[model samples]
Target chain A: MELTRRDAAAALAALGAGGAVGYAAHEWGSGGDDSPDAPDDGLATDEEVRDALVAVAEVVYPSAVSGIAAFVESFLAGRLEREDHGRGVRETVGELDELASEWYDGPVAELDPEDRDRLLREVGADVADENPEGTTAERVRYYVVNELLLALYASPRGGELVGIENPQGHPGGTDTYQRGTP
Target chain B: MSGPATNRARNRAVDRTPVDGADVCVIGAGPAGGLVAARLADAGYDVVVLDAGPRFDPGDRQERMERAIRPAYDRPDVWGVGGERDAHAATGEWFYPLNHARVKGVGGSTLHWQGMVMRLHEADFNSRSERGVGVDWPIDYADLRPYYAEAERELGVAGADDNPFGPPREEPYPMPAFPPSYSDSLFAAACEELGISMHSVGNARNSETYDGRSECVGYGTCQPVCPSGAKYDATVHVERAEQAGATVIDRAPVQYLEHSADAVRAAEYATPDGETHRQEAEAFVVACGGVETPRLLLLSESEEYPGGLANASGLVGKFFMDHLFAGTGGVLDEPTRQNHVGFITSESHQFYDEADAEVGPFKLEFFNYAGPSPVELALTGDDWGDALLERLNAEYGDHVAVGALVEQLPREDSYVALDPERTDHLDSPVPDVHWNVGDRALETIERANQVQEQILDELGAEVTWQAGPDSTGPAYHHMGTTRMGNDPEESVVDPQCRTHDLDNCWIAGSSVFPTGGAMNPTLTIAALALRVAEDIERSL
Candidate 1:
């Protein structure tokens, strides 16, 4: 999948259905803020980036779980609220959308399901080739999918996928060590 | 030696009419101050202990952890430096950064301590005699042995007495050792296979209630806060000091000591509100940790004592030292599932005698880490979505961080001095420190790193995170700022930790440590404080 300047829409329909959070599209990647002086506003809201992420999450966390758009939007909004590197993250999300739009000839958030999957696989292959060690992709996918997975997997609902008895940092009894192997 | 029992540690105000009955004044109610103050008051001395930080109730452990971990406000400003709203100084420029590694409060730094309590080895006391580097401690391990035992009992240390590498002890730990964490069992099996012996570290956490405190509820946030009093914090002794008739005052940072020709007459302290109060005492014990103790002495400059109150030998704030801290370890195939028991569950002193004076000795606080934090998960981890979750599930907790806390030789160049220009809220000089990882320590760190790798390899783990010599930072084991020795010219305190320059002043903490071995420093600090209180009681 050598797809780099390449890489999001089922995300918007879901957002329109969920109305999880508000946003202005294209705030992050547009700032070109991968510098020390970059504002810690990497999580600034971007409708287009949010839409792209939901589409990516759909491909990433495939299931009949219909709220990918709302989850991604809520997670990005929280990042903008808490972390300094957030605005840069929002920027990367915008970049991801640009790549997807360029490749598919349509907004990623507005793409057909099969096209969205194909675009994600191509981006994944390119990210793997470019960042064999994985750090660059982590940054590239910070707002798009990776961080969303962390927030999701660390939740009681999502933690069920792993053998995790309790979400990390939560106060739970020790005797409840995971009963079965994943 | 008795009067109205007051606990200004929370919000109780001191009467303006300089409270007169206090026979001894102890500053900084941390592990050092708490033990000494309690001992003195128990001996019926009418002690008055002053802590610059606010008195934190153990009940607020959850709230404090929430506030402490945030980017905006860390733990409450127990350092007497500033409040939560005030931004902390960027200390990255310093030789070593404390960066929330130390805390200030009624319990002092113990509020943030992980409680890996252990006594310095017998060989640690006479390092100069054994290896010929730093000055030897004026007193030997024999002198502190009884105090160490008593301290373990008083603080409720839990562990077996069978660590082959541990120094001979008079008694077993006050409580049976905490059940080994899952990581401990795996690491122990690994060490056994490699012909290396591992010991459960003597922890100040409780197994069952010996004191009025409850057993461990196992919330797993033991570093800065323990929701259950299962883990020991110095605040327990602050209340005990009050019960023993000592007046415990909080937010009272001692500004200076009033002294006559060769004796300290009273301690002058400032309230957070800018009000000043003086407590007259027969003698004064400075138990402020390594940093603030020297800061206090250096700030107390007078015409007679030009260098500082305890600087007749010009050695009040020299020979500062901290553990030579660095991490060396690897990632394993299966999760160790460690965080359940506690941080620093086990350590070994097998390498304590490996080097003579030319290189520092060290101990390994060994355990499987809880694994890469949420941030690390995203950065270095592969895949996304379901694959991401699958990868994290497989690799997240499968890691260990064998951090070595190596002994440091005291050098005069690395010291704590008052900044000439910078001042705190009370206009007292802010402490400016210069720390250099000694060239000798580099040799020790290299060997320690090698040992760390050996452990990881023995555990059949693949090496991942390796910290080089330059990456070593503070371990919070502050010591030797006010070096203790027999010679007045070469040391600040005598064998009893009293200032050689002054008759009625003394110190109680690792600040008086002449040569710090690779122990955690809390047990030894508490032992020394108890010893100092004994001496002060005799003088009284």
Candidate 2:
């Protein structure tokens, strides 16, 4: 069996742990005004983008990491400006906000880490198989969380944690090639 | 031996009409066309090669690495519809979503090809006679053995070629393969622990610096782009063809062929600016992949042959094939320490020959994709914040992945024809693929699953991901659309890849493959191209 997030969480839940352990694996995909998502009307304001990054970053990344919010916001905003997928990403985060409001009666940024984790897990798993037809959280995993995590680890700061030390394109010293493969 | 020219020069591409005279016109500046154009031009025959997409170079090693390591453009501007002008794969029912994977450029899909180059097993050639499945190729493995040897030298292949699993070769590979990483070594031991035979296969990538290219630098990204130029892309050969007096025109989408009296007279290409350009040549070879080849043939419908050009057998776009692929991944308790390194190391044909008469043979390729990237892991699973980061920090590279390519027998129904409604920007009809795997392929996939399980289980892996039957991702080898056979009545092209309808029009690349074995088709495609070029030269 593949150790999915739900699997690990369920394992933790079985251990009677607290603080995001017992997430409600509710039957999801409800709520919202029932109109189709807008075709990416550019990114939201800087504050909105920053809030979205901080909310997800607080849930997905390690705590006490300085400048985490700044790193994520710049990465997210920069991608939105460039790639076409960035527009979809911006829309997905807005969807996450919608789902967060429905589930917790508040925004993702305001919700405690536990509630945020719960909503993300429930929404994320619901849309795991196939998507564009799910609650905001479910699709947010695809659009926002997916890109967020990608931006985090594929960067130099993220690479340092995993022993990559100097990410290839981080504008470093003379040698750039990683002599790892044949 | 018979591929790249030693001349280093720029490939001056024509932007629009009034094309330069050429002895031959080859459509698609890909592996086959690039090599053929180079070979002809080397022999002093003026050649013109046309590609639909713009020519995008990966630049020098460091720059290429920079692009690969960056985001959005992380995969080079070679994939998808709008980003880099690659085709939107016309998918059919039950076929995998293939549009975002294949690239379009002067180097063609070779720019994005994973450099796994292995010859078809001898048994693969006689499947019709021996296995009682699929049509027998008009030519055998022995017929193309010399050309395969030549392609290896030209492409700078490195491997231990004296394997019992492989077909007979005239000589050893040009260089020994790169050493396997520690994780790969563990995977090999696990395979051995389960009594499975494992060996390294020939890779087109350089093990040590040879020719003008550098060695592999382990960027872990070979599919989208190869940084060090160690893995051979067709642009260098296309440039060589240019140096030898051949011309490659960018954005010249070949819409149709202009033929008369059972011979192709001139080729018509739609320029980017909505203008048509006529290029006449002594001979015409369409190497624009399997789908594009048939699409072009069908789009070039004439009054004499209303159905399609050179489609006299009505098999021009039939029997389209892709190898049955099943991927498996698992995580280990201990870090492999050799994660993120990206050389394709060991391959096992231990389970290649199936005893079950219901299924075709399959080859399981082992890869050291031991790192599922901390970000991917964090994004997935039920971990959040410190939990996610802590988990990621501990187990980044402690992962392993292995996959198998089951031999898919040619089925008549799985085909590629011109979509009746759809057309490209050039107003040429796009390919409509009707492809799917059957019960035989499923059985092969199940067997592959068992092999994957046997290895992972022995290693005491905690978790695994094997989308066995759900694996529909294409292996990217487009073949058998313009299949080769002895009878003109049954096949689109003859054994020498000459269309029965047109004497001067020949087909090149994997498009002419009668059967696609469980190995990557680039080298085989290269071999066929070299052989066809030689034949074309002799004829000229």
Candidate 3:
């Protein structure tokens, strides 16, 4: 099912995007490398970040899930507007691209779906304990994998996939709660 | 309307500028204060009510509900609780999370409460006479029965006359009870097998539109915020009081009460714009819940009454009480449809009046929001795609739980006192709650859990979790601080809720409860507040 930008924005707001963004900024500020090999501004362009997130969403979300690219793109628009979250996303994408360049001789956004999935596994993001400030793997899981999942599930369309017609924040009336599933 | 103002300011110069003296000045705009102010105002008595917190706009409830639903928004921050303003000290075996459990705004804690309204059983008032433990209240069930009906109607309670264990009522509830949730239906057979009878819980949330409020449209975030004005909050009565021509001031925390040998002269309060104002009245009512009511009295220490204002017995803050919770939950083989209902529908009070048992009384609750919500299950899972969908379907439903509120006896050791070292933003000693769970309470919790396990076993469910006796915590129903009694030396207030030491000054709320039965205290708080209003009116 198709999800709109409004659904994605509501999802982001429910997940406390501002708090997550602040945590991301704090994590990146304290632990991020200041190497010359990094981007000149220590941030990637919005297009680059969007491309990388959509690529990662392809691997993280269910294969049955449709319109992932549009959903992730819509989700990113709201997320990237926040300066702190934008910089955190940009830096995270830059790090992923650096690793892709070293391992696959290409950027993550250009890799095949299977290769992109393998890249996340190889970076230990699939196995790492999800933390905002622990390690590269943990940061990837916190900012990339979890962020996408939270956005998806918090949305009404995504919630429908699991039979949650009305998530907690949404105003599902009394009749909705009174009976069993039809 | 100005009265004599004395030199009662502790740290700063007292502002003699009178902030509208009335016939009755009610402190704390909670359920108790709201009811008193409304009744007095309607009776043609001039009333002024002062609240320590902001008057939240009802329009902001949607955003507040969102804040409650979101994981990152701190729960206390949802009601604007925390900081130095709400700071309190806890010296108990179990950490009394006061800030998390209370709201100080115009609506008070009812703004975030679960809206369960149950009257104390007949035996609750005669615990010493019937059960051989705890002190008997000066007034019994018969005394408050009419007021309970009035309170139920006033708060627009939705309930049925189904509880055989409940005290006798002369009238039906204002509205019919909400039908049991789907999960409650699932537990019916198991409960039947165990011979544990379940009945509808009386709730302030509207089943149908009553008293101009909307019917509960199940926003599901009832604890911290109800976006719809379906659930009854004290703001309802506060507004009613205002409509009846009572002056209600918010963000005006009373610092101290200046009292003479026989009566309270005035209440010195601090306003938002950095000014102190004294309010004098023919009668004064302190309805600031259990903790703050005693703290305020203790803060009102005078040279005439060295212990505190109307604290001749030195029992102003003693005998503090709170009901402890016992919870048990498991996964049933069939779908239970958990997390659909935010408030409870089914409860068993059969064990609430066990006179022969050594353990204290307890009321069993069937939890509707027992299991994890869809968002919680989705966010925590490690799987993705069809695997994630499989996990969600497998784990989302098929969960059920039962909780019980066990009675805690009022002990002299468990008290609310002024924390000498820590002061609040008002530059007065914050309330120090010294609470300790006794052996009887622990025994009661164990017994309650056993009964819960029996029902779960009858369902052939795998027990996922159980709150053992040691794991028990309070249900946040603060009571019995300024206990009411016939003797002035033992209790702070008399049977009429008037201070034994002062003729005109009165105390309202659960602070005057001699013994808190294992029920939600708000209903009784309302009943007592209504009664206190009558007492104040008669005296005036």
Cα lDDT for residue A130, candidate 2: 20
Count of backbone clashes, every candidate in sequence: 18, 6, 1
| DockQ class, candidate 2 | incorrect
**If both were scored by DockQ, which would come out higher, candidate 1 or candidate 2?**
2
| Proportion of the native interface contacts kept in model 3 | 0.46
Best model number under DockQ: 3
User: Which residue runs does candidate 2 get wrong by more than 4 Å?
Assistant: A1-160, A163-182, B1-14, B60-93, B355-357, B375-388
lDDT of 1: 0.68
iRMS value of model 1?
8.5
Write model 2 residue lDDT over A60-169, tens digit each, in one string.
Answer: 76664556565554454444432334445656766667777888888678889788778777676423522333555555655566555555555545655665532332
Error of 3 at B224 (Å): 1.7
Clashing pairs in 2: A5-B381, A5-B382, A59-B385, A123-A138, A181-B218, B1-B154
Q: Quick one: ranking by lDDT, best first?
A: 3, 2, 1
Worst 10 residues of 1 chain B by lDDT: B1-10
lDDT of 2 by residue, B392-458 (tens): 7777656777888887778887888776776566555667778866678788888888888888888
TM-scores, one per candidate: 0.75, 0.76, 0.84
lDDT of 3 by residue, B1-540 (tens): 011232123113423245465899999999999999999999999999898887786755755665564443578978889999888999977678888889998999999999999899999999999999899999999999999999999999999999989998888899999998887887888899878899999999999999999998766788988878889999999999999999887778999998889998899999766889899999999999999999999999989888888898999889888999999999977767666558889999989888433799999999988777776555444565567777877777788899999988888989999998998897889999999767888999999999999999988889999987878888888898899999999989999999999998999999999988899999999999999999988888
DockQ of each model against the real complex? Answer: 0.10, 0.11, 0.28
Error of 2 at B46 (Å): 0.5
